[model samples]
Target: MFVLLITALIKYANVPDDIPARLAAARLPELVPPSSLLYLRVFMLAINLWAIVLKLQMIEDKVIFHSPESQLPRRVEIRLSGFMWCSFFTFQAWALQTFYLAGALASSMSAVYGTPDLGARLPVALWFAFEVSFAVAVLTSFIVKYVLIPRKVQNGASVAGFFGLPDLLMHNCNTLFMALELLFADLPVLLSHFPLAALWGLFYVVFSWGWLARHGVCWYEFLDPSLPKAIVMHSVVLGVLGVFFAIGAALAAGAATISSPYVRIALVLVGVASVARTGLITGIPEPPVGAKKE
Candidate 1:
């Protein structure tokens, strides 16, 4: 199911030759550096593949080495674990980000090289999908690690459920590595780039609205802009989420320099404030009429 969904999304986002030709004809400068995109694509793919291989090895060790007498049961356990892990929101976000980077790299290369018939470029949907996924990956990792885990611990939930070496390596470590890679690979972590994250969210919101305009199908209940209140709420929530993720990504990249206790305290305060602000605003209104089921 994971494979099928990813394959379908890739096919949907695959850029046709006409797109590059159109861009060339328009004579617009390629905004993205092709080399950077290439490096990012390689890095993301290598890390994800390595993580998968590691997980498979761990599964093999568990099933073959430790549980040899229970071979069939171990196999079932491994398969079930694999399925559950793949179905995780974090894993899906990681997969989407990986595929999106691949598409973006291909598209950027096509634009840079004047490849009118390049078959690997990404469409806007795929591009937006990747950007959103990147944000989701960062935010999800941050919340799970810093917020959710602590809350779970305070509530007497088993810490064993929250911390596993395999899960940390696959989800948190990979995300941090990717963030660091982006920082070093000519994509400087900047306060200015943060707005681009919010802009990406707004773009997705508008894109969904455009879909509804043409097809009469609202892609998401919160995105039906026909309701003025829904528009305000969705815009604010997405915009805030985008900015929060952007901040998290930047901090992850700059983790080496964040040695001061004061800075850490400030970051925690800011994060808490942002979450409080979002919750307060979101709770003020009921679901918009457009969001209600018929």
Candidate 2:
């Protein structure tokens, strides 16, 4: 846990270093100095690190490996996960590109050498759109093959009876983590780009939850005796997510105070609400198909 905390903090902390090029290009007035950015950078790094370690440990145990009549499902899972990560990276890249292009245009009088005009923006936007579209498509495939398809053929296993304590713990935890990350990403985008914030937030949550349902968590786990324990564990995870977002909100609020006190408060409120919604998702587990209490 200690290591994970530091990891998240480090990710948050290195923001300045990671986006220096983008910042310079965007010509975004350095409202916050490099020193201030360093602090936030370290904090975000720590948050990310903590999330990574927890997810890695949880998924490592849950991901199954076997040779089956069809390797399609396994391959699809791998592909979906890979595509999600790639989408994240590409989104970051595109944001950086936008900043650089916008900055160059600000400085340049002529539309020739440095400024990225409509021509450049169009291609970058198209690429980002394609990346997002591809991610959504891949995720849909995973749902159809794994979540919606019959599982008995894999090992004569009952889809409803397959999950145990470990499965419940992993499923709930991963869902919570992913939800929070998505929320965090959306918060800034939402605030900066008001019209699209809600749309993006809805898209992310829907896609992620759909993926979970497709992976076989579509049913409730109410019949499972282990449900109580799973609830507790999930609650604990959500609590941690809440803490992380609260801190992030506070930082963002402080940085943006020059604009309006009310605005800062509103931003913080959004952060809090996002965290609460995340907790809500984990509060109940989806039942496995055909579940009956013993």
Best by lDDT: 1
> How high is each candidate's TM-score?
0.43, 0.28
Candidate 1 lDDT, 62-108, residue by residue in tens: 22111222212222212334533443445555666666555545555
Instruction: Tell me how far the alpha carbon of residue 131 in candidate 2 is from the true structure, in angstroms, after superposition.
Output: 13
Question: Which residue segments of model 2 deviate by more than 4 Å?
Answer: 1-33, 59-258, 275-294
- Candidate 2 yields a Cα-based lDDT of 0.31
Error of 1 at 113 (Å): 8.2
Using alpha carbons, what is the TM-score of model 1?
A: 0.43
- The whole-model lDDT of each prediction reads 0.47, 0.31
